[model samples]
Target: MHSSKRKHIVVPLVLYCPLATFANTNPVAADDRLETVLVIGEQIKAALQAEQALTPGNVTVIDSADLYQRNIANLGDMLRYVPGIWTASGSTGDSTFFSSRGSNLDATNYDGNGIKLLQDGLPVTAADGNNHNRIMDPLGARYATIAQGANALTYGASTLGGAIDFTTPTARDTEPQIFLNDGSHGQLQGRVTTGLVAGAFDGLITIESKEWDGFRDHHQQERKGVYANAGWQFDDVVKTRFYFTYLDNDQELPGALTAEQFDENPYQAQPAAVIGHYQYNVETWRAANKTIFDINENSSLSVGFSYEDQTLYHPIVYSPFFSLLINTEQKNAGTSLRYNLHVNDHDLLAGINYGETTVDGGNYSHEAGRRKNMTTHVKNNADSLEIFLVDRWQIAPRWKLIYGVQAVSAGREVKNITVADGTLYNPGADYDSINPRAGVIYQFKSNNEAFANVSRLYEAPTNYELEDDSSPDNKALDAMHGSVIEIGARGKRPLGTHNKLHWEFSIYYAQLQDEILSIDNPTAPGTSLSTNVDDTIHAGIESLLGASFSLDANNNHRIEPLLSVTINEFSFDDDSHYGNNELPAAPGYALKGEILYRNSNGFFAGPTFDIIDERYADFSNTYTVDSYILLGLRTGFTHADWEVFGEVRNLTDKEYVSLFSVRDRAAPNAAILQAGEPRSVYVGMRLQF
Candidate 1:
């Protein structure tokens, strides 16, 4: 699943369809669509929230408001406050890597594969389960749902880390605006968005351009993108929406600097990066649609399909004589069908999602920027078909039992056209897995609930991970499988007339077989090697607490304190060499907190802090990435249709590593670390009409 490209596609942000724009053009149509909006709003938000609460596993729904005006640059920063999700980024806004509850515990690179990413409940992650962060545009989304662990069975997401579905906004929530941000590191951002409605159709579109002179030398970057959606209603019972997007991205690679180099000149590029002009470039196009049909008062059917095409060009220094040059084209297509039924006290959902992705790739031997010769060429293809069923039964007014299952069949095949060594390729394999989940939710009181669940998950090896060139076996690697048991409680309630509290906490433990471990290729910088461990254990605790207080009349003055933490314990169950050793890159503790204040006159301010415990940098546990703390502040003013925000990151100007690479071994002088961004300031403004 890992390509070492460190980029995540941002397509999902454009895949959502919100047709409310059309109803706004005509008063009669507006009134006609109002009923549909009310019903669909539940389909888009409230119902999803209610469904999430019914899951015994940890699940969360985040509104776009959480990041809309916060100067979010990427998913890494976008998900900073989220629990159980940890990210390691190469630059302030570059590509990022993530791990949820130690799921890919030893992954040391930026490719996010273990976590399932969806666009409006359809696959954004490719057939092999690899997802790049390029498809997401934070400001263009309506909200997102995070289903942790087995709770993702409804989406047929069998990965240990679960799944995320990002929904887009409708005309009702749209505000046409122009925005810009100019800040430290010679960064500049400009964007324009518009929404409109006419008759039975609605449409919204956004265009953006950005450039950054990066914190490090020779790491300049530029990007241009367009996102748009149009939705139409044929009649009261049938409606369809279409999505389209285009993105162009080019980023210079400063590569990694050694610890000593980081302390000396963190802004300097790696030697190879400077000499070979290392970089990555991408061009993409995507189109998708979702249509809903009201089957009856108590049931509805939804169907969707999408297609995407991408071109990638990358050059990296893998060795002194032969840096790797990659030219590839990827095509992806998927379709989804889901039926929702609510009959009496029973709720059921049945769905089938299918996707296929093909890669036409070529590897080359290069000197500087020119390819000296072709190494190999191949067509690698993967496909996935999944059927899932979930049912929630109300046994009593306050108690409910939920059960779900997913049947998945997946295959990966590679046809090599050039002569290559055995270890350089794998014929690939096919896999079938059955995942089952059960949970119970008990409402102890208003706005409060206790829940528990047990589930099993399975994840197959990705195309890249099957690169065990040493074996001629069609299936070079085995699938990773696991079972998890979890219990938790969550709720929100008012303590007094002027104060309110919201809290949630959960603990989970899992036993796994053939757990995958990402091992660095010591001989080639940035290259990876993955293998399976016989047995492993993963456990974690996640919690969030927030309290709000109103201090004056009209409820204008308000104050709040927010706290979040995650504790992880992942280790080898038994191994002769590692011997019950904790997994590398798994932080023992990570915490975030904030104190915020707001005035009735549309003014607000907040100070936030993040702290991470020391983490092992390798399997041997001989080297480590030290703990670091970051302090930041955000202030904003919103009056009528005008919005202004200012953000200061690393208020202390503390120099640190926002993220680092884990490998077979590490040293002070090797290229294995990325310096955290220096203290920076960003000021932004948006005007809506």
Candidate 2:
């Protein structure tokens, strides 16, 4: 039995692997190759190659093998080596907050801004751009892709942070397997995956269950889920896949504690939370399909459709005096189409994405731990449509030029179903915009390239922001618009050596108008609110470096070192209250590094470290979370048909705030913190047949 996180980091290992046949997520099955006649094959190549060659931007690809080495709890664990994204995690598996490009610096909710989430090449985010982060199962994913900024235009995403996609394994790549894991705080996980391939038909299914007693008091969760997919090949040129997903989760919330309370007892839940029995629970079901057709040798077309249903029950106590019981039923549908063409030295792609979501919900008042009366019943509908085109021309042998344009339309509508106290839903609002991009890349050296790009970004307000008619200060929230310019480089060392170094680095600057930020009302405790900032600046650097070293004469013993870090200097350009002060929440600088030594006989051990600089807790910067460092040790034995791993975290047992809620102008007494978990141990094992 064991004790106990790389994704989206561009490395030479992925680029040079010749056996990477299933890297692309689409309707095409891995074993759909046609051995009969000259079938119009080659329709299943990964889009990453085209996008990387044409777009002057950063791209990261993480394969399943990469995930086996780390903890598979949340997206935060999977995106550890990812450069641009920042993740702050909570006690439960799904209680994680992550964002890209410094978007919405103060809010820690699941509604992702500036970043789009996708599963198997289809949108997981609702039409209003809100994502249920729990829907993803990292353990079931075969690979993941990260597209940064405008480079994600091909995916119909034009946010400042970019897009990320999770791809599942198919029958061709799956074998009968079982996994078991046990960790600190009574955490247990069990999963099984099996698949079968028969002639032109293939099917795969996965089932998983998890239970955990969290590091913090009252933070407990139980989860059960299933993922299944079936594929058929009509011919060598046509293929399609149908998928289904189901999840049921029960989670207890441990409300945030005041800074003073956290200092005295990091593991204790707020008294009000315990008394009110705060909880967040949901049951979700989803179905999706993807099809691919090869028009000819030079072109291909892919289409995807999805439908999702979810029911949620949220009970929380914002303060000792205020509580809420919110129940919601939601329906969401989405469709996407993309066409790719390659002729001569030119690469072109055109795509459209459309999604609509409807919410039938109400918010009720609660007396202490019991529901009192219904306060507001409302229905909200949100929709988004986007069309985009990208063209890449290789004007010279060493240079490429990329140009792109996108058109978007978004709308939100609300209806007062049972208004007890006037109407709490805002009047409907609609938004439309057109954005353009240009970029250039040069192959300045062997296996190395330099890139630069400029793009315009637009983000629409989520339903929550546009429908906050009850809040006088939040009713008029505006859509956000910004411009970004970036330059970067990626490559590996010289070719004739056993030891190689791989690296990628980029720097970006963004100027934004109407940047959305959290605004707290001193009178309404625990109510989330947002307001637009007139001007803001976001500038940052993203980097990943890795090296392989030979330590023995036969190269049987080796060492691998990896370092990933992000440096941010985000601030309000000029505002009445914030002036040019740095933003709150995410640390200004965070670094993670690991060094592993391994023998060819399937034995490996490593030392890993995380360092985070001090950060302000609110816009007023009245207080700060002290800087912290964590040291960990991991070791494992990996062999054919069987593997096992163990790890220990927080060797120093340092006291630190893992996450916090942002406030408006506040004194030191107002900041609330979620303390980091104490030292822990984890162990896991897997069997394959």
Tens-place lDDT digits, model 1, residues 1-689: 01212122222223211222322445545334545544665567887778777788788787765564567666777777778888766553547667888876554344566788888877888888877434576666778888887778877797888998888776555555667777887677766676776667878787777777788876777777888888998998999999888988777778778888887987788888777767777789889999999978999999999999998777776556557777789899999999999988889989999999998888776776566666778678999998999989898999999998999899987765654653345477788988888889999887799999999889887776665322445555678898999999999999788889998899999999987678767665556777778988889998989999998756889998888899999888887678888888768898988888988898989998989888887777778888889999989998666688998988998877666677756665666777777798999887654
TM-score of candidate 1 to 2 decimals: 0.92
Error of 2 at 660 (Å): 0.4
lDDT of 2 by residue, 267-351 (tens): 9988877777777788999999999999899999999999999998777755545667878898999999999899899888899
What are the TM-scores, per candidate, against the unseen true structure?
0.92, 0.91
Which runs in model 2 stand beyond 4 Å of their true positions? 1-50, 132-134, 318-320, 367-372, 416-418, 469-475, 494-496
Model 1 poorest 10 in a row by lDDT: 1-10
Model 2 lDDT, full chain set: 0.77
